[model samples]
Target: MKSNRGRRRDMQIAADNGDRLSKLPNDLLLNILERVGTLDAVRTCILSRQMLKLPTMLSQIVIDLSLRDLVRMNGVVADVTDKILSARSPQITIHKLKVKFLLSPSRCLSIGKSVARAMATQKLDAAEFEILTPRDFQNCTEAYLLLFAAQLNNFLHACPDAFAGLTRLHLQNMRFAELDITNILITCKRLESLCFVECDAGICSVLNVEHARLVEFTIAFGEFKTVELSYLPKLQRMTYNYWPCDDNPLVLGFVPQLSELNLTNAGLSDKTLELSQLLANVHTVRDLYLNFHSEKIWVRPECSWVLAPVLAQLRTVNLDNLPEECDFAWTMFFLEAAQCLEELCFTVWDHKCCRESQKSFSKKTDVKWEPSSIHFKHKNLCKLTIYGFQSDKNFTSYIRRTMKTAVNIQEISLHDRKVCKICAEKFPQMEARPSSYPRTDEEKDSLRKKIAAKPTMVASPAMIHFPS
Candidate 1:
């Protein structure tokens, strides 16, 4: 239907576009493919002849079942993994490799042997295996936990080469014996990161770890009574979830390079944890995160002199999950001890789904404490971040006090309550206090003025922000 001139112009425009994408640099195009994931990237190769070679040139491969069509995905892990790995050219060295699959002996053996073959042929920078239990965690029984651990032990024995090359490993819903966990750590000599979800040695057994090359470790919802970081020289970051211990959940050992630590627990029967004793061995920590899980606060507030020795090097602190109505002034104890702290963040929310009553969770109350180091002033604190911030005195007075203490404070970011989609959907009829986050410039200015009008002390001038 078009004329000769029109036909020529259309073809010329298409040519100028260089087949729409074929002219892009190899690295840029590979990055786009990598971000979209390996399986999706392979399908994209059909778009153009130029992209067909991209799959063979990939340096990273990740096959996460959660990212795929998860319906009935339990049994096809072996076939999918073999197809992807077999298609790749062995000459291209993989920089990162991750495969998450369910616990099926035959399928798992096939996956491990395939990875072992790949490791023998090419240089794999890092490899990981995320093994999922046969059923959901809530449906797991004691006998099932023991059976899964034994099967994994046999799997490790069958493919020693693949286990040796792995740099990261994640296991879930397997309860190993005291010696089983120690043996796995020894076999995986090059491991740098390890994660365990609802897996433990026992309910009240002591677990000792001795890894030379391990750098980052995480354990969530484990029943171990006391975990000893016996000897880990290169360890830097550690995340520990709920524990049933009465004292400190971790026993710090020879970890000189440990810099960041995150601890989260729905308080275990109101047991108070003292940082001085728990962090006595590791003093180089620069960042600390503690989540109280919207229940009773478990940390015992200490005086500046008592906690200063260990908290002296701390630069940032995050105190999360405080009940919205409780007094936030109790958090000032960190600024009192960590004289070098540069940033402090807090999140105050009463999770509706976690609540037993409609009003609030403050019935259990927060850790009762008062300021002990009034004369001390923090010169390095530059940022204050608060979620679920309101214009009431509970928050305003706390801000005014912190401003007076943190003489060099530069910014205050106030945000609304973090939305929990699961809670909203599960408890649709539950009531929550209306959010008071400022929606306009006038409201933000008014709240800033109210907190800044301090007469008792010369508060440092700082910019206040209401994050939208």
Candidate 2:
């Protein structure tokens, strides 16, 4: 019921005092916006003119555009991205910039320009660029090759000095040769972690990664003849997954601090590729993970042939899909050498093919698992776990053998495949049956009952666990 003039004056005073967030400085406002989210902060532009530029103050910018989005937004995504990067204040540094887009020749230029501009102005802690092409690019002929080549060339060349301040960088689907990678590594002097996935390394016969400050590195799905990892004193973690290395051994040198190593699908099925020389320089590694093909021996289990350096400090070891019938040569070798091993895990793949494959392995017949040997005492091994356990006689015997020697063993856990969510989710076809492949439920139940009927063979005070 106040007069109109009085109401106008009150409104003007409120505007002068500023809105709820108007009292905060630009940095504090940006911090609030960052915590609230970029989308919400952008919406605040309607509330006041000052907030129209709030999104540019964000330290982390993630732009993801796909084919579906390109149709609806009609390529406004790139323009908006450029504008956001351009508007960002030079004083405010970007911590992370992750951009994922479907690759196109025109879009590649825009992306390269935006990324280069952003990197030029800000000190990025981490940057990830993912160029995903359509799965059916083979049908497109020369267009596919042209698009990929243009994108890769423009991206790498455009940002020569961009990665100097970056701590972490991830590149996906990039086709770079040895010289290209060396240039990137040289420019990224402070890079701590680097990852390449599905990258084309076909042009390079030998790639040398010698980074002084690099701490962690990963390469997957690459066709490299030889990869030399040298002079990386601070490297702590390394992963080489599905490496189609073309029968070339990895050359390792001067990585004194490398601790954790994962080698999965290493294509080492051939007997000639010995692991001893490959792991000779990595004696300092503590955690090791190896996933070998079911049909082949990634590492030969011949006791007479020394295959690896003794890892005295190895605390954790994880193996996948080990042949159940084979002699525990690898297991025995690790246990004998790794005096400080605290945990051991085996992911058993319970399938009919694995059983059939085990029968063909001739080494199992010659080698005998004699747990009574005086060298079987392992006092440091505390926890042992087996996933996808079918409670087969061979596996149970192996477990019983371990329990007898591990005097200080704390726990022995055997997880059934039927109850394992990961196994069921990964192999839905296998989930139709309860136990071992090609066996009936009644037969499996009988086998389980018979196994359970036996007296618990645990000698030590170790806790024995089985799935309910």
Candidate 3:
């Protein structure tokens, strides 16, 4: 009904109102684009001519393909990386960049060269690379590992600048030579975090790590006789899992600032490792985690005289995957020590799949430990959590003992057992024990009255939770 000029003005107003995102400030537009991934951001700006330059101005760049996408997208990833690096302006500083690609020498050579050129020309704050092997750990043969490691070496050799400025690296499924890993450590001088999954030297080879500025290290499924932390002064957290060793798994020498340690292993052997020998050197550890894989008791409890000094600064202790059939009273050996311990958590789970598939012949042995005679009342322990909680004599007795020991305990949490789908499907014949957790408010109050009426219960007014 209006004239042509008036209709054109209305259409312009509608379009201007619709395209509000582009009119935002440059700083805010960059922030929004960065929150979305770099790949998605570039795709989003395809039709918008005013915002086509935002991708080049982005500070954080991440080009990661999922597990199902690596094979098909490896070449695509290389092409995109090269395009991004070549198109990006050197004036804008890239704060963080990560590119993950399959270990193909040709593709890696292209990507590595682009990143190296960027490092030389632009202001890249930190660069990271996650190199994936062709095959998985189970399917990888020794020859495959050697070939993949050599390909990675070639990539490193081609673009030394990329690795030199890298802050994090995760290598998988490789059996490096004795000096190969040491050389990597020497070359990656600015590395803050490093991880190796299913990687090691030859059989029975000791992995002696010596790094000055490394902060976090993790090794999973490695066949090392002993991984000696020869010198990692600034190390904060270390995790070691499934180290197939009969002797002590780790030997710490000069990890002064180490505060957290995680160890996970499934051992059915009768050999029990002593913590006194394992942790005699590092005393600054504040968080400790040990997982037994619901099999045998692998760690032997030490006397207070031997363990107290080592656990002096320990604040949190998590003991995971204890078999549900075993008694929980033996874990008090740590509670009696650890004067500064604030939180103690325990998980009693029976992983049927892992037990039957991994070590079908190994039996779950009973843990034997007695409380220390030295009278030391704990005042710092305020919380206790139990997973796979059963309303049985073992659980109640353990709770009473903890309540009495920790007089100022603040709260108690009881959680239902964590069920694994694979475990339930594989072991369909095995029936899970029914939990006796109270259902109604009246029943819960009745249990609370009973717990409070018991004479062994402490006078501390602690709250109890039964989470369904």
Candidate 4:
């Protein structure tokens, strides 16, 4: 045992000597240090002389503090920031700092001040500050807004030069009005991607995005009325949403080079022709999504007259719950007009009124229902998906007729509410299947045998497959 202990100590000493002799390159050591957090990277400096210089080579830094850490430690925020700044080399560029402050107003302000101080010395590429609190801003007083504005001013002052090189900006749940956002956009010359969530600003405040390089923009309004998107020249993708408001029409215009457009709950009256008119002007758009949540979405016979010309250029169309009897003639007209149509998606609401109307049509109409008439045959059409299929006699008959007409359709997908056992047994490989159906007898028997063979099987849930 004495001899073994002496041998072990000698081997450890030899390994230490080898490590000291074989020093890693600075670039390689920095790469290893970059994998760790800012705190860990700074901690590594105490390991050895070579590692003491590792933190200085760090180009990227991330700082995250827990809510408890903010409250427990008196000057931890300042101390950490000082250490990071001391270790940062002037040659290092592209610093990313992320701080999560979940504490009282005073503490948050202090942390913000420390971050601002750090930004003054470091060449920060991007700075993200997130405040995760459950405080509702709706009932907030003027005092709260003033405090927020002061904090934001401090943050901005700290990183005055930070935004000069920033190409992407994402601000979420920050209490700000339209004017503040417009000012920020003006300063951010190279801003490419901007996202604003749950921000309220008045209608007259036009969101003028003058950044010529702006590519993607997303804005969500909670209680704002009237939005204009006319000034963005280089904008490519845009998502605009508005809450229900009776005061003004959510106006959307401009973006000539836009390839993708998404509109959710756009407060347009059922009788209004503005939506059709807006669609008419977006001639350069290749992909379009329009979701209407109004109770009345009936399309008049003349709807095709207005919509057909605009939709003719669309490659993809997603229509959600238009009026059930929304002029089938107009539907046919739009389908026929969309010459470049590749994929078609249909979502129907299973309403009692719609079912009753279909029944009434079956009783009164003597005209033969041709399957080919319903089958949308576009030369480019290859894929068709139908949702809300309720496996009723009328629906099944319509499917059969429609399938016969889709000559170019290579793939068909259906999401049925209820599955037919017979159909599941017959067409297991088909793209269309009922949602609820029993597994094959062989599978059931196999599961039963496994359960009987092992008592542990009873403790586990059985696997089941159901089509959607």
TM-score of each: 0.90, 0.72, 0.92, 0.59
**Total clashing residue pairs per candidate?**
0, 0, 0, 1
Evaluated at residue 317, the lDDT of candidate 3 is 94
Largest lDDT belongs to which candidate? 3
Query: What lDDT score goes with residue 114 in model 2?
Result: 74
Better of 1 and 3 by TM-score: 3
Q: Model 2 Cα displacement at 29 (Å)?
A: 9.2
What TM-score quantifies how close candidate 1 is to the native fold? 0.90
Evaluation by lDDT, superior candidate among 2 and 4: 2
Question: What lDDT does candidate 2 reach at residue 388?
Answer: 68
Q: Which ranges in model 3 have alpha carbons more than 4 Å from their true place?
A: 1-18, 356-362, 374-376, 459-462
Candidate 3 lDDT by residue in tens digits, 159-200: 888888888899998888789899889888889899999889
Task: Please give, for residues 1-468, the per-residue lDDT of candidate 1 as tens digits.
Answer: 999999999999987785666668888888888987677887777678888878767788887877244336645667766766777787788999988888888888999988988888877899999988776678899888888989999999999899899999999888897689988998899999999998998788788989999999999987888989999999999999888788657998999999999998877475788898999887899999998777767788888788898998999999888877667777888998898999999999877676544544446565567777567688999999998887777888888888888888989888888888878887777677887777888888878877887776465334888876
Best by TM-score: 3
Q: List the candidate 1 regions with Cα displacement exceeding 4 Å.
A: 1-29, 46-53, 67-71, 74-76, 84-90, 355-362, 424-430, 460-462
Candidate 2 lDDT by residue in tens digits, 178-241: 4777877887777888887666445445678899999989987655767789788899999987
lDDT per residue as tens, model 4, 1-468: 559889999999987985662287877777777777766777766667667766656776655655455456535654665566566766677456655544345555565555555557766676555453323456545455445544554555554444434566554445555467666676666677777655544433444455677788777654455555656778787787654454333444666777777765522443432446555556666676654432233222333446567666677766554333332223333345566777766655323222223232222211122223444454666665655544344444444333344445555555544334654454455444233222456644453343234442222213221135
Ranking by TM-score: 3, 1, 2, 4
Query: Each candidate: RMSD to true structure?
Result: 3.5, 7.6, 3.5, 12.2
Q: What is the lDDT of residue 35 in candidate 4?
A: 79
Q: Between the candidate structures 1 and 2, which one is better when assessed by TM-score?
A: 1
